[model samples]
Target: MRKPLPFGISVFVALMLLASQAFAAPKSDLWPMWNQSNEANAASFDHQKWQQILDKYVVVKGQHNLFNYSAVTPSDKALLDQYIVDLTSLDPRNYSKDEQFAYWVNLYNALTVQLILDEYPVKSITKLGGFLSFGPWDDDVTRIAGKKLTLNDIEHRILRPIWNDERIHYAVNCASLGCPNLAQTAFTGENTEELLNEAAKQFTNSDKGAKIDGNTLTLSSIYEWYGVDFGNNEQAVLKAIDVFRDGQKLEGWSGKIKYDYDWDLNQP
Candidate 1:
């Protein structure tokens, strides 16, 4: 038979046991209430307003899609504000999976543009403020279906986890040159897949996306940061890239990869 331990020893052991139990428990899914099975309601979420705004402000300069931030007219700003209001008024759960995906992606991109406009003349999006002044990603920028959400919440909690599609990285733009080009038009449920494919193909072919210099295969840091999403390894990332490249092979590929990123605002 074992004797009872001292009070301090007993307390320490109990704390350790509790800690282990806590660590073993699975984390709860954040968007557990999001209705994934709902079929798309025919009630279209109008993106015409967003399309107008994009057409008026975004321009294709050389290879980059640059927004004329300084040229945004008062009317365009009003249109953007109204678009956000219209978006937040909808109940996303009523929409289909594809619709919801488009909704979130559009909302993220629009809000990002808004952030830049709100603080125009800034060199980079990373300079915006949020919790602890780290960035604007954590700021509670909007509400959908009565739940307030930050940009990070929309991206990580909802979009990334729900869709589980690597191509999503292309769909949602970061308003930076290093990030995938912001689509010139608004994303609608009808065009989400096509738009995603186009964005991926365009980016993969761009010098900013991938470049071969001698023996080195340089890629966007996006692949370095989210390689798991592309495929969990370097070779897997190359495979995904090749898919968009239409089976084009990189000869003399030394199996070496380098990552680069440009934080300059995609501006004109």
Candidate 2:
């Protein structure tokens, strides 16, 4: 009793449905899962080369850690490039969660440092990338497991989502003076927890991380931007910060929270 669609029209509708499905697929489909199985392989990934570079280039000047971007030799740059290539080649899902965690942390930091070195003598990391771009975060700077990824992809999609840990904020440096200092040592599976805790403590204790100015609380803009990632509210964010404050008091502090950040390159 009902008439069917014309053959040509039916075919067109089928194709349209297929196209919609393809377009609607989640972007996460393009990336490998952060963790595949609970069981993990003991296979080792070497980060000695990267550690050497960090040790030689990162300097601790008082409260800030500065990188000698201008002093990086051509040979050192080559080593850095090779290290990234090796890191991106691995299937992170094949490793344990801790190993994978270290992998991403090191990769993110290494890529950031490389970005600065490639465009050294610049005033800020934000100055790199396309005309319409805010920074290199959205640029597909590396390929991992057959998928191209930007710094944003690694930090937001993979690292933050998988770990769901606030300390990660301190782990991934933005190569800016106001950001948490880039550690002088590389992150590894064996030391991942230790390093993350240390980084958080160091940052919270520093003025750039948090400062109480009279009746107002001046905090890093990171808290304002990614406050949800920390605890989803101002009070929760302050509690998270206080965890690393080492008993320092912000007593008589006003509830007013002001945010500030410096985009200047953390250069020596």
Candidate 3:
């Protein structure tokens, strides 16, 4: 015979379950329309403007690369707006997978920057969300090929499901200090793989990503939130981490695994 939890304990457990469900990470659900790609097409989209913006505004300040949101001039802001317009105007499905990968990654990063610029001086990106909303992720930020898309749509529904690359986590920036650094150069088909590898290495080695203390292992909440993408268990997650760790292999640390994240804006 099993003993039932006391009434107060049962209520607390129920509340905890509700809280977990409320903050659960979005799943990778495919949007078939985005899966359409023309492998034979040999055209390259221009990302020069985006590269210019990143080069000028993003600076390496300690371990993380922070954006100079406050330093952006009106002309530069206009340039960024035009760059986004140019990106959304194209139908990415008309390009090959390599090109599409770069396009979506750049678009997602640009849109996130634009969102922050739109609501600048806020301490965090979460401030953009209304009382009922957690963040502006669900808001339609752009239109591509006649279909409006939210950040969540581009990331979870399109990129994650279509590519099935775990490194995609490193490529997309959430405008948060805890997130993987927004690459200094814009992602292009020719350089995405190199950049992805670099970003993964940088993040995994940085304290923001993982820290092994005494006998305990503490990691970014990302690995916890998207555990399935990284392999869905502690050992599997450690294995994924091992791939990018710069130093010695993560060995037998039979201690608690704690996850933490800082939502503070990744801006100077």
User: What is candidate 1's local distance difference test score?
Assistant: 0.80
Give RMSD (Å) of candidate 3 vs. truth: 4.8
- Candidates sorted by TM-score, descending order? 3, 2, 1
- Name the TM-score of candidate 2: 0.86
Best by lDDT: 3
Q: What's the distance in Å from true for residue 52, model 1?
A: 0.3
Which regions of candidate 3 are displaced past 4 Å?
1-22
Candidate 2: residue 151 lDDT (0-100) = 86
Candidate 1 per-residue lDDT, tens place, 1-268, comes to: 9999999999889867754442121111357666463683666678888899888888998779998889998789888989999999988888888788888888898999899889988998867875224357778999877788988788878887788888888888878898899998788889988999999998888878888777778899888777778876677888888788743454335677798878789998
Residues 84-188 of candidate 2: C-alpha lDDT, one tens digit per residue = 999898888888888888889899999999998888889988788876345788899998778889888888888877778889899998899999989888888
lDDT of 3: 0.90
True-vs-predicted CA distance for residue 28, candidate 2, Å: 12
What is the Å distance of residue 234 in model 3 from its true position? 0.9
lDDT of each prediction vs. the true structure? 0.80, 0.82, 0.90
Better of 2 and 3 by TM-score: 3
The lDDT, on a scale of 0 to 1, for candidate 2 is 0.82
Question: What tens-digit string does per-residue lDDT give for candidate 3 at 78-134?
Answer: 999999999898999999999999999999999999999988888888778655466
Task: Give the count of colliding residue pairs in each prediction.
Answer: 0, 0, 0
| lDDT of model 2, residue 158 | 86
